[model samples]
Target: MASKNLENFLALMAKVKGMDPTSDASLDIMQDYVTPDMEFVQPPSFPHGGVHGGRDGWRHMAKTLNENWQLHISPDHMWDIPEEDVVVLYVNMEWTAQKTGRTVHYPTMELLRFKDGRIARAEIFPQDTHAVLETLNAHD
Candidate 1:
């Protein structure tokens, strides 16, 4: 059986997968599954890279990423570490540059920590950060 934390994580991902990143609805969805003190980490190579603290910071990062690229993420696998209250998710992601129409396809491994059944920390590790940066910097 899947842990409650993993189920909540999957539910959250499903809610946000196709939603507008900057929309109020998206924020509401985030609030449902994430703690107010949530921390999100992205690769420095990304335009919106860095460690984002709190829900507001996460909102900023999501909005910035959406503005720069159209992202499609499909979860490939997920494992729950019940002892540590963490869920590890592997996803296949495709980012299409809005300006240049270039696309970068990569896999990402994410570590999510839960607090009171809500996501409190998330760290993303992309398989090919260089390719992602190249696609983002590409011109038509």
Candidate 2:
């Protein structure tokens, strides 16, 4: 059951990434996979850099990302900590700065806490914020 839940979460993420962020399909997937009170978090070096709540928060995050960069996210490794009901994922993230056309690639680790098969909280930690920032700033 845990494995199936993890697969569903990963599939939802992939489907969302492939579709237009504002599309009905994407919104539906977000609603299905994320809890209504879910908290989405990003590290300080991330563009938005804070805690965003619920599906609307995801929409805001998508808007910020679309406005600032083009991104590709790939899941690398995933494991579940049943005790905490958390799924830890290593993700490969690549993005191009829309403003400067500069590109950066980095590994991001994410902790996703789940409740009733939906993500209750998601947190992202990039391996090297300085490198990411430097690459984004290169063409400036």
Candidate 3:
């Protein structure tokens, strides 16, 4: 059986999927799955600022990403490391640029921190970043 935390996490993940990547997903359900003062981060050399703090920051980042490129993430696995207040999700990302018609797929890992049943922080690492961007930019 899945732990209650895991179950809740899955439910939250579902909400994220229903969210339109082109819009404000974080704002739509922030109260349910995100803590106040949450942080969002992408690893070094990320196109966006390395880190953005709070809900507003997340929204801005998401909007920017959507405006620049199309993204799809397929979840493969998730682990609740409650002892560390972290959840790690394995996924594959497929990106297609609306402008160029180029596409690429890559494995990715999303590391998130949860607090009080909400997300506090997140980080995404995609293995084939060059391929992803090339495809996305091609359409542009």
Candidate 4:
């Protein structure tokens, strides 16, 4: 069950990166994999910088992020918490700015909580946020 849940998340990210966010497939993936009340905690310095809730929030976040960069995520590690319905994932990601054509590769740690087999919450902690900001600023 844990592995399946993780795979769903992986697929979700893949769809987000590989297809247009507003496309039917992308929207369907989001609806099927994530709970309707799901929320994402994002760093203020990041491009999609806020607490985004629900499918609409997810769509808005995708829009904001796509406006800035195209993201490619590579999962490095994943572990399910023993006493809780949560998974911790470490990922290496590359974000290429759409406008400037500049890219930044960075690592991020995310805590995901699941409810009834659907993702309910996610909190992201990016390593070297300053470096990401610096790279984005340089291109701007």
Candidate maximizing TM-score = 1
**Segments in model 1 whose C-alpha atoms lie over 4 Å from true places:** 20-24
Cα-based TM-score, every candidate: 0.90, 0.83, 0.83, 0.81
Encode model 1's per-residue lDDT on 60-136: one tens digit a residue.
98888888887787889999997899999898999888887889898899999999889999999999888777776
Clashes of 3: 4
Clashing pairs in 4: none
lDDT of each: 0.86, 0.78, 0.72, 0.78
lDDT of 2 by residue, 35-71 (tens): 8999988776677668988888877876776677777
**Model 4 score (lDDT):** 0.78
lDDT of 3 by residue, 17-118 (tens): 755544665457654777768788865454554787887777777777776567777889888787787788998777776668687787899898877667
Instruction: List the candidate numbers ranked by TM-score, top first.
Output: 1, 3, 2, 4
Q: Going through the candidates in order, what is the number of backbone clashes in each?
A: 0, 0, 4, 0
Pairwise TM-score winner, candidates 1 and 3: 1
Q: Would you list the clashing residue pairs of candidate 1?
A: none
Over the stretch 1-140, how does candidate 4's per-residue lDDT look in tens digits? 45656667767777677565545567777788889999988898887888999988978887787777777777789997635768899989787777667788989999999887679998989887776666556532
Model 3: weakest 10-residue lDDT segment is: 18-27
lDDT of 2 at 133: 64
Candidate 4: Cα lDDT at 128: 79
Report RMSD for candidate 1: 1.8
lDDT-sorted candidate list, best first: 1, 4, 2, 3
Whole-structure CA lDDT of model 3: 0.72
